[model samples]
Target: MNQSTNPSEASLHAIDYWQVVKNRYGVILLTFLLVFMTALVITYVMPKKYESTAVVQVRQKGTGIQVIPGMADASRYQESSSAMFFPTEFAVIKAQKTLDAAIENLDLVNRWNTDLETVRRTLKGIVDAQDIRGTSLIEIKVRYNDPKDAQKIAKEVAEAYRERRKKLQGDYSNQALDELRKAVIAQEDAVEDKRKLLSQIIRTEGIIYWGDPSVSGGPRGFTKADDAESAAKAYVDLEQEKIQLESQIETLLRYDGPQLMNYASGLSLPDNIIPVLLPQYQEQKRQYEAMKSQGRGERHPMMLSQASNLQSMEKDLVEAVANLRETLKAKLSLAQEQLARLKTRMDVKEDDAVKQGIANQNFVDAKNDFETAQRLLEQLKVKEISETMQTKITEDPIILHEEPMISNVPVSPNVTLNLALGAVVGMIFGIGVAFFLEYLDTSVKSLEDVERYLQVPVLAVIPKDVGVLYKQSGMSPDAEAYRILRTNIEFNRKNPEDNAITVVSGGAGEGKSTTLVNLAYICAQGGYTTLMIDADLRRPRLHTFFDINNSVGLTNYLTTELMLEDVILQTPVDNLYFMPSGILPADAAGILNSRRMSELIQDVKQRFDLVLVDSPPILGVSDASVLASEVDLTMIVVQHRKLPRNMLMRVKQAVENVGGHVIGVVLNNVDVRSDSQYQYYTSYYTYYAPAESQPMPSPVSSQPSQSPQPRAASKKTTSADDSKQDLY
Candidate 1:
C-alpha cells in the first residue's frame, strides 16, 4: 500500500474549518439559544425610563450702562462676559451644594427612595444643559424612572434658574446704577466749571452774540457792527476813487482838446503811411502804453514808438492844457499831483481797514463756536445727571411645557429570534457530530474508504449475516457477495499460475472462513475444481460448516503419519473439497510453519485449479502469516466497525514480514441494506433461485452401483451424484 501524502495548506485549512464547524456546532447552537433567552429575559425584566426637558433663554445684561474710556460697549461686554459666566452656571448646577438644595426643595431623597448622596448621584445622571444652536438658549434635559418625576424635576430646575438669573441681574443693575450716578454728578460739575470759564472769557473779550446761544442755532459771532462799519467805509472810498478818475479824465480831454485832437490825428494815420514817416513816434507811443501797463518807461520798445508818441502827446497836451490854464498854471500842476497822492492814501487806508475788520470777524466767530460747545456740554451733563439706569430681562427663560414623560418598551427578548438562532446552531452541531464520527471510525465500510485509507484495492465486500451460507448449503445473497470476490480475484491475479490464495482477517469473527468456503464453491461452480483448507488449528470452524470430522484433518496430516488424501474430504457441493483443522494443536503456529505444511499446500495447489486457505485472524496469531508466506496471494478480511485502521495495518505488516504479498482487502459482514452503497451488489442474490430447483433424474445401476464403502466413522458424507437412489 502507498503512503498517504500530506494535504496542501489550502486543503488542510478547509479540512480544519470543516472539522471545527462539525465539532462545535452543538456548542454554537447552545450559545445562541442562551444568548436569545438572556435577551428575552432582560427585555422582560429591565425598567423603562422617561425624559423631560426645559428651554432657558440667556440675555445680555448691563446693556444700558454708558461708561468712560477703556470700557467696551455695555452690550458687547455683557455678551462676552456671559460666555465666561456660563461655565460657572453649569458647574454650579452640577455642584453638590446646588444638588443638595434641589434635593431639599423637592424632598427627592424620601420621594425617590434614595438618600441624599444617592439622590445627588441620580440628579447628576439625569440633569444636563446644552446651548441651543444660533441662539442664547439652553436646553435642560432630565431622565427618570417615573414620568411625573421627570417632568417635575425639569420644571423645578427651570424655576431655580429663573430665580438665580433675576437675582444676578438685579444685583448687577444696582451696582451699575450707583456707579452711573456718581459719574453723572462728576461730569455735571466739570461741565459747570467749563461753562463759567467760557462765560468769563466772552465777557473779557467784549464779544456780542446775535443768534440763539444753543449749539443747534445758526451761526453767531461777536460784534457784527464793526464789520458792517468797515465794509461801508471801504465802499465809500472805492466810490470816491471812481468819481475822481472820471472827472480828471474828462477835464484832461476838454482842456487839451486841440493837442488831444492832434495826438488822435497822428494816431489815426494808417500804419502803412506812418511806419516810415512816424515810425519812431508810433513805436514810442506803443511802448509807452505797453510799459505803463507793465509799470515800465515808454522808451522800452525797440522802435521807441511808444516813448516818442507819449512825449509828443504829452508836450502837445501840456501846451494845450497850459494855454487853457495859463492864468492858473501852478493850480493845474498842484491839482493833478494832489489827486495822485489822494488816490494812494485812499488805497492804503481801505486795505488796512478791510484787513482789520476780517481779523475782528474771525475772532468773534471763534468765540461763538467755543460758547456753543460749552453750552452743549452743559446740556449733556444735565441729562446724564438726571437719567437713571434701567435693567430688564429681554427674554425670560420659560418652561415651555416640560418634557414628555413616556417610558420606552424594551423589545430585546424575542422568541422568534432565539428559535432561529437555535436552529442554525443545531444544524451546525449535527454536521460536526457526523464528521467527528467519520474521523474516529477505523472499520472499512466501503471499497472507497478502504482504498483511500489503506491504499489497497478492496477484493470484495461480504454482506452481513453470511451465516445463512451454512444453513442453505449452496448459494445465498451472502454467498453471492463472496462469489463476486472470487471473480475479482481471478481477474486481478497478476500471474495465472498463482492460484493458491490465503484468506486472513485483522481480527477474529470477520467471516474469513466463510469467505474461503464460498469462494471455493464459486471456483468449483466455474469448473475450477477448488479446495479450501482450514489452516486455523487454534480455533477450527471449517469442519463445523462442512460437517466433517476434525479428528484427522490438516494438522494430523501435516504433523504425523496421516496421508494427505486421508484428510481431504469431498463436500456435498460438486468439485468442491475441504481440509479440516484436525484436532486442536497446542503449537498451531509451529505446525503451520513446518516444511510438511508447505508441501501439503504445494501438493493441493497442483491437484486443484484453486486452493483457498482459511487462516486464523492475522492480528490474533502467527497462523495467518505462516499461511500467507506459503500462499501465492494473501487477502485480508475486515469487518465493518471491527478493528481500528492502525490494527489492520499491523495485520498487513505481519503478513508482509513473512514475505507474503497482500493482494487485496475484503470488507466483510457489511449490512448492505443499511449501508445502501452496497445494495446494488447484494440485492440480486437475495431473490435468486438455487440451481437445485432444476429437474433431477433417478440414479440407475451405472457400474452395478458398488456397495457404498463404509463411511469414515468421524466424517459425514452427502452424495453429489444426482442419479443415485438411497436405500437405507
Candidate 2:
C-alpha cells in the first residue's frame, strides 16, 4: 500500500466517467426529462410575436452653406471616421426624441388606450435600430403582437429619424449663412477703404497707372520725374575721370626728360602726343647701340649720325611729354567743373525719385489690398448665391433602401431551438451533478481506494449479491472470488500456526458473515479442513445459514463444561464445519473476552487446517474487537462504495489496537458491470462458468447434519433444516 499517489493512476480516464454515467443513469435520465419538460411547457405557453424591419442608407452630408469653401468634401472620408460615424447615426435613429415623434405620428397613445408616458415607453421598447455591418445602411426593426402595428411602427421610426436629421441640417445651414453674410459685409467695407486710399495717393502724387496692379508687378509709371540712377551714373563717371586726369598731371610735373616721357607713355589720356613720339625715340636709341656693337666710336660718322638722330628724337619726346602734362592739366580743370554741375543735377533727380518711389509704394499697397478684398467679396457673393440655390433645392441625405413589410409568421416560441438548448443544457447539468456527487462520495470506489486508505492488500472483489456458496446447485461464478480470497489468505499468513482468522466489518450489512462462510467453503473445496465459527454473540446469523441449532453452540460451550464436539457440526459439504452462535448473550463482549475463548481459538487452529470466525461490526460493538484480539489474524470485509475511507481505516486501526494482525481486506458487493475498473478482475465469472451443455454438479445438501449429541436440541434442528435454505 503506497501512501504516495501516482499521478497517472490518480487521474480518471474516459472509461471511468462512462462507468459513473452508467451507475447513475437513473438520476441523469430524471434530470434530463425534468429540464426538457420545463422547456416544452414554457415554449407552449409563450406569446407569439411578429417582426417587421425597415432598411435605410444613412450618409454623411454637408450643411447647405459653407462659410469656408471645401469644408463639406473634407468630412467623413477616412475609414476610421466612418466606423465612428455609423454608430452615431444608429444612436440618432434610436434616440428618445425620434421615438417620441414616431409615437405621436402613429397616434399610439390613443390607438393603444395608454397614457403618453406608457406609449413612449412601449414604442421605445418595440423599436430597435442598428447599422448593418460593413455598410451605411441602418435597419429599424419593430416587434409587436400585431403584424400591422409592427410594420407601421418601423415605417414611422424611419421617417421620424430622417426628418430629425434634416431639421438639424437646416438649423446648421441657417447659422452658417448668417455668419457668411457678416463676413461679406466686412469684406466690402475693407475693399472701399483700400479704394479710397488708392485714389488719394493717385491725386496727390500725379502717378499714372499703366495696367492693373493685381495683374502686373505694381504701379509702373512716375510722371513727375525720371529715374535718378542715370544722373548718378554720369556724375560718377566724370568724377572718376577728374581723379585720373589730376593723377597724370602730377606725375608729368614731378619727373623730367625720359622719366617724364615714360610716365606720359603709361598715361592714356585724350589726344596725348607722347604715344606717337616715344616709338621714334626708342628706334633711334636702338640704332645707336647697334653702331657701338659694330665697334664704331661715338665720333665715327655712322655712329655720330645715329647719336645725333637719338638726341633729336629724345628732345622731341621730352617736348611731347611737356605738352601732354599741360593737356592733362586742362582736362583736370574741365572734369572738376563738369563733376560739380552734375552732382547738383543728381541731388535734384534723387529727391524726385524718392518722392515718386514713396507715392508708387503707397499706390501699390492700396491697390493690392483693394484687389484682394474685391476677390474675397466676389467669392462671398458666389457662395451666398450657391447656398440660396442649395437651400431651395434641398435633397434628403437619408435614403430608404427597403420599405417595412408586414410579416405573417410569428418569431417567438421557437420549438426546435428551445428543445435543442434544453437537451444540451440538461445533459451538461446532469453530468455536472454526477461528478459533484462523485466528489462528495468518500466511499471506497475501487480496490486501490481500499488498499490506499487501510494500508492492506485487497484479497478479492466480491461481485454484488453473492449468496451462501455451499447450498448452490452447481458451481456459481461467484465461487471464484472466495477461491481468490482463500489463496490470498494462504499466501499472506506467515506461519502455519496462525490459521485462525476472524472476518470483521466497519458497519453492519457489510456481508462479513457471508464472506466468512464463502471463504470456508472455498478452502474446504480446495481440500483444506476449513471451519466456520459464528462468534457474533450479539447477533447470531451464521446458524441461520446452515439451518443448524444455535441453542447448543459457542455460548453454550463457553458457559458450560462442554467438549468441542458438542458444539461443532459438519455441514453437507465435505471437509467444511460450522460452529453456530448458540445463544444470545446479555454481555457479548464480556463472554467473548475470556481466556476460554482464546484457548478455543488456539485449539480449533490445530484441529482445522483453516479456521474462520465471524464477528459483529467492529465499530458497532465490542464483541468483534474481542474476537479480533483472540484470533490469529483479522480480515476486514468492506462493502464496495458503502463505508467511508476514514471509517474503513478505523476498522483496521481497531484491530491493530487490540494486538491483532490484519491479514487483508475483502472488498465485497461490487457492481462489476457498472464499475469498469474491476471488469478485468472479475471477467472470468462468465468465462470460467460451466457450459450450459454440461450437466450440473450434484446438489450439495442445503441442510447440515448435526454431530452426535447428548442434548435433545439436535432433534428440534431436524424439522427446521428440512425447509429450503435461505440464499443470503
Candidate 3:
C-alpha cells in the first residue's frame, strides 16, 4: 500500500518507444508518402544530358639535340609539355578565342536561345579536358541534350584548340628566334672588341715569359738584377770580416797582460819582430810582478833594470798592433763602398722586375680573353643554326588522337539512385517531424501520463465515446471502468462515509460532467444512496442527465427556507437521487458559498451514503473552488489528451489551496481503440466473465481481475445518465 506519488519512476516507465511508434505510425507513413511522391515528380521533370569525348595527341617539341653545357633552349622549349600543356588546353576550351570559334561554327547563340555571353558560360559548364596518363594525348568532353549536338560541339572544340595552338606556337618560335639572332649579333660585336684589346696590349708592353732575358743569351734586364743581389751579399760579408780583424789588433795593442802572447801567436804575427817581442815581454812582466809581491824594493837595481826591459817590449808590441789596425781600417772602408754600390743596383733591378711582371700578366690575360671570346662566338653561331633548323623540324604540339563519339544514352536523371536518395531523405525528415510533433503535444494521453505528470493515481479510465459502449447489448466494457473508479475511491479514502466528493475539471468539454453522472449512476447501482448535486450555478447540467426540471432545486433551497427533500428527487436508477441547479441568482457563487449551502451539503451527506457534487471547471470559475473547499474529498475529471499538464496542476492546486482533500484523478475520454499507448487499459477486454444466467461463484472464493469490470445486472431499462450522454 504505497500511496506516495513517485513521478520520476512513473515518467521513466511511461516513455515506451514502441508505444510511440504504434501511435504515430499513421503520421510517419503519411509524411513518407508525401515526400517520396514529391521526389519522383521532380526527378521526372528534370532534363536529360548526353556526353561526347575527343582525344588529341600532344607532341614534345624541343630545341633539336645539342650537347652544350648551361644550354637552356631544350628545357625552355619542353616547358610547354603535357603537364602544363593539358591545363592550358582546358583553359583554351573555355577561352574566348577557342569558344568564339566554336560558337561561329555551330551558331550557338541562336540554338541556345541566349546572348553570346550566356552561350559562353553554358558551354563552359558543359565541356571538360584531361590528359591521358603516360601518354602525350588529351581528351575533350562536351555534354548536350542531343547526342549529335554533343558530338558536333566536341569536334568543333578540338578543331578550335588545334587551330589556336599551332598559330600561338608559330608566333612563339618566331619571337624566340629573333631574340637568339640578336644575341648572336651582339656576341660577335663583343668578340671583335676583345681582339682589339688583345692587340693593343701586345704593342704597348714588350712582354713575354717572366724568367727570360733579352734577345741575347747573356743577362740584360733580369740577369743584371740577379748579379746585383749576389754582389751585395759578398760585400756585406767582407765588411763583417774586416771589423773582426781590426778588433783583434786593437785589443792586442792595449794589453800588457799575458793573454796578448797567445793573441800575437794565433793572430799570425809578422816575420820580423812581433813573435819574439810578445813572448819576451810576457816573461819579463811576469818576473817583475813576482819580485814585487815577494818584498823586492822598487828602487832595487835589478828590479829597475827588469821594469825598463818590460816597457821597451810593450812599446814595440803596441806599434805592431797599431799598424795591423790601420790596415784593417783600410779594408773596412773598401767594403762599405762596395756594399753601398751593390745595394743601389739591387733596388733598381727589383723595381724593373715588378713593372715587367705586371705588364706580362696583363698581356697573358688579354690573350686568354681573345681565345675565350673567339670560342664563345663560334658556339653562338652553331646555336643559332640549330634553332633555325629546329623551327623547320618542329611538329604540332596538339593534335586530335581520338575523336568524340555520339553517346547512346544520357548521363543524368538516374532513376534508381535518385529514388534511393529520396527514400533516405524522406525517412530522416519523417522521423524528425514525428519527434517534433510529440514534443509539441502537452496534453495527457494515457493513464501513465496523468499519474506521472500530476503526481496522482489514476482512479479510472473512461473510454472515449463510451455512450456506444453502454448502448451495446454485451457485457459493458465502460461500466467496469466506472466500477473500478468507485472501488478505488471507497478504498482510497480514510473514512467510508467521507464521500462529499466534488468532480471538477480544469477546462470545459473535458467530460468532467459525464464522468460524475456515470460515476454516480454506478455508485447507486452498487447499492449506495448517492445524492447528486449540480452546484455549478453558472452552467448546470446534472438535471439534464436526470431528464428533470432545474427550475426549483439547490438555488431555491439555499435562497429560501426549503428542505433537502424539497430539492432532492429520486433518480430512475436504483439508490440514486438528483438535485438540479435551480434558478441562478445574480450572485450564484454568493449563494453557493453561504452557510445554508454548507448545511444543505451536510444534511444530504447524513441522509445518503454518498453525496457527489458536480461543478464547473475549476480554472474557469470560483464557484467550483468554493464547493471544493466545503467537500470532504475532491476528484478531478481530466479528459485524456485534452488538457495540458500545467492546467491539471492548476486544478489540483485550486482544490488543495481551498483546504480540500484530493482523492485522486479520473482519466476520462481515452481513445483506447486508436492510440496504442492507451490500448493496455482495455487489453483485458477479450477475457469475459461467466454469463449471468449461470450460478455465480461465491465472491469470497473467486479472485477478481486486477482491473475488474461490472458483472451484468439483471436487464435494466434505459438509465438517466445514458439518455443524457447520448444527447451529448
The prediction achieving the highest TM-score against the true structure is: 2
> Model 2, 1-728: lDDT tens per residue?
45455555556666688878987777788888888888889888988889999999875555235545553445324533655677777777778899889888989888999898888778777788887887778899998989999999999999999999889877876887788889889988888988888888888888777769545654567644555888888998998888877777777788876777777887776677778888888877888898899899988999988888888878877777767767777778899889999999999999988888777777878887888889989988887776666667666878899999999998876789999999998887788788888888999998888777788899898999889988886778888888778778777878756878999999999999888888888776655566889998888798888887888789998999999877888877766788888878898888899999888887887666668999999999888889889989999999998988888888999999999999999999999888888899999877887664787343233322334432211211222222112111
Q: Candidates 2 and 3: which is better by TM-score?
A: 2
- Scanning candidate 1 in windows of ten residues, the lowest lDDT window is 704-713
lDDT of 2 at 367: 80
Candidate 3, residues 447-548: lDDT per residue as tens digits? 777778778788888777876222245456567777778878877888755879998899888887788888887666555556789888888887777678
Q: Report the Cα lDDT for residue 434, model 1.
A: 55
Model 2: lowest-lDDT 10 consecutive positions: 719-728
lDDT score for candidate 1 against the true structure: 0.64
Order the candidate numbers by TM-score, best to worst.
2, 3, 1
Local error of candidate 2 at residue 468 (angstroms): 3.2
- Identify the runs in model 2 with alpha carbons over 4 angstroms from their true place: 1-47, 62-72, 76-81, 111-115, 212-218, 222-226, 258-324, 351-360, 537-539, 543-552, 556-568, 595-603, 689-728
Candidate 1 runs further than 4 Å off: 1-311, 314-416, 436-456, 461-483, 544-552, 640-647, 669-728
Which one wins by lDDT: 1 or 3? Answer: 3
